[model samples]
Target chain A: MEKTIGNKTVNVSEDGYLIDLNEWDKDVATAIAQEEGITLADDHWKVIEYLQNQHKNDVPLTIRSVGKSGVVDIKGFYALFPEGPLKKASRISGIPKPVSCI
Target chain B: MTKNIVILGAGTAGTMMSNHLRRALDKDWKITIIDQRTEHHYQPGYLFVPFGVYGPEDIVKPIEKFIPDGVNLKLGAIDKIYPEKDKVVMVSGEEFDYDILIVATGTDIAPEETEGMMGPHWQKDVFDFYTLEGSSALAKKFRDWEGGKLVINIVEMPIKCPVAPLEFAFLANAFFEQKGMRDKVDIVFATPMSGAFTKPKATEKLDYLLNEKNIEIVPDFNVMAVDGEAKTIMDYGGKEVSYDVLVTVPTNKGSDLMERSRIGDELNYIPTDRATLQTKVKENIFAIGDATNIPASKAGSVAHFEGEVLLENVLNYIQGKDLKEGFDGHANCFIETGHGKALLIDFNYTHEPVSGTFPFPGVGPLNLLKESRMNHMGKMAFKWIYWNMLITGRHLPFVTTKMQEAGKNFD
Candidate 1:
């Protein structure tokens, strides 16, 4: 499915994660973050950049890893994204949601 | 010159690979599997231990029982792997060189990662069911449990058998019902996931099950610490959920060997090619199951599914052929919805679990994503299959390494 975020249209999943990261940009991220009641600040972008960088390297994301990434602590991560930090960060970063399906 | 195919961990994935490759490799090519643990446990049975559906005797067996005759089973702690040197160093000061290395070093619960988890009430009111000792201890604790607020909390994601906690909640409901104390117990399932199940359609169905069983779902709760003295789990967001007895699935990580070797990720899981099961560490090195940072579920079934792809990849690596991107992350699991019923979910990397017929297209032996007695039977029957067929590297009849989408209702 395609969703219009800010001035750009991008593919998204039913859960609203960006289907293709190539279509992601700052405007799109701000638009997605806006839906979650989060305004992208410098710290949020740092987390988003960290998440995108991790996704690029194929390292599976987790709150524990994000906390240990030296980008932010767990409490700081929650404070940045509020609730569901990993999912929110992934969404704004335009990466697949980090999940364990067993 | 004699060559070696060294395997780490004699658990499900390692043992199965050892059996699968031993007969195929030439006599000159030696296969040695190493693990510190002596017993091979049927890990799925751990979910039933706390409920007494299965006993300690049922799930455990000697590791030596599964190793094929030609393969050598080295029982010792592996200190590190020098991938560049093609060597494995044991903690006891012994070293073994290998032509190829297979790391099936499965994950384990790290309760100490969470503050106060291993504190004063370690195995008393606060318990973990991932380990044999944990499950057995939990069973003993449940013997005279009068039932109050029983919270089953998962501290983090990527835990082994992702659905086991939900199964625990469902079984707890059934357990209390059988004891004629269902109403006396308030069941709470606290997880980091957004819902009872991760998949959408499955969540829709499972959410109904949770409601029907009266199990409370507490989503988006990431544990910062276990307040053992207060009997509460404190999330990073400052959400506190109190419990009379808490069964938590703590942070799970790859083998310590990976940590010692400095070849693993932050969680000590080896970064691997998701499709090929080949590790990023080295060309000759491959990782499978819970040990690798594959997005797939860290369950025996995932390892079982990956075995076919990984086996082919190893053979390919030996033959100097290009590796096939054959693995599709196929995972099949039975969700115990309690009342002697369960839901069987069959899915892959690209597909979510949908309602359909399994093994057979339209003919009805087992149903997917729908609760049935047959699915529960399939789950129970899996134990025998695990012991007899799975560990022996034989394929189950009608099941394929890749998921069959013919009978499934997609959309």
Candidate 2:
């Protein structure tokens, strides 16, 4: 499936995650954040930015790593991404889903 | 030089192993995973089916969808495993040679093992949620249930998703309350265990949940049989618990092929080195998930954690290197306590679940052994993660293959 993020159309999986990493950008992320009902604050951006860096490097992004990244603690990360911290944060960061989350 | 790696049963453990090994091993290693089923059933979601919280569509997906690229998915029933030859034969008489074999056949519920459990009352008043069909039938039964005695029992231990029966009772309590029929339903939880759960600290919290919801816990009640005609479950001591609805978790056993191969123990589970997951019969053959006689919870999370350790050991075996004894039996579960609240517990072989903040000590967004709405949401969100992440062999960020005790409170 595909979702229109701003003026760009990006491929999304059945779960609404970015299928192609190349199609992701700030505009698409902003659009995804809006769709998820999260207003991307600076704290949210910290987690998102850290996730995007890790995704770019092809490293797995776990909640603990995000907490250890000095960007945010586990509680603050959850506060930034309410329901599913790793999932929601990864989605907003436009990365492939990390499997170890639960 | 091509080498073959054959994995039996492409369910939770099998699927994850395929993905993990595919990425970790060299291109010379050819991985083939075999399973009889085309569809992959998310076993944990079976608990919610009875309460209508999740439907059939929510829990199932194609096994091929999760099978990683560069891996072969062989769909067939196994005939036998010849450990001496390091080869597996299918029921169709086809044979495949392997340099290494991973038995991840997992376990199945055997309700027929108990007397009268699957009698005429089954799918009418008695049901088992461990299977898809039983769970679906219970859903319809719960829809029109006027409510009387609702008894949830465990016929035996070492069942898949061990906490599912308790989760059902908690959800039943919430389901009834949502329908305004809570007063009419008399919920009783019958278990062979001494408490509401196995772990002491976690059990303390779960006992409180059962008490707070007015659900009775009949612990140490060894079920002998079920009088289906009379709608009562009989214990060994001849005590009977009457029920309008009987939900049971039957005796779980490994594949019949395990017995056919003669490498299995009395219960048909392959005897394995607990730390290395290598079968006692053959160093070339290993077992993971519910297939091994490892003293680990038969939960998906355990399989995911085991996948990490197994991948490392498999590579070491291929390279003629020493296998690492790193598997700590790390297992964790999110317990649903109903009314939009849930509790999370993390533990391993040596550590019982304790009260503390998870991942980041004192900075947890999730509390251990404490009910919270976030935990419930995490439980719900797991279905998504199970499908997208875990099966794809993605390394979870902060979680380790072994249990960590830095933030845990034993005091």
Strongest candidate by DockQ:
1
Model 1 CA lDDT for position B395 = 89
Predicted candidate 1 versus true structure: per-residue lDDT over B111-146, tens digit per residue = 988999997798899899998899999999888988
Model 1: how far is B347 from its true place, Å? 0.8
By TM-score, the best candidate is 1
On the 0 to 100 scale, the lDDT of residue A101 in model 2 is 15
Task: Give the alpha carbon lDDT tens digit for every residue of B352-401 in model 2.
Answer: 89988877788877888889998888888889888888878787767778
DockQ of 1: 0.62
Tens-digit per-residue lDDT, A40-71, candidate 1: 89999998999999889766678888999999
Query: Candidates' DockQ values?
Result: 0.62, 0.01
- List model 2 lDDT by residue over A1-102, tens digit each: 988887998898877899987898878888899888888877887777788887886554545457668889755776677645677778878887664211
Off by over 4 Å in 2: A1-102
TM-score quality measure for candidate 1: 0.97
Best by lDDT: 1
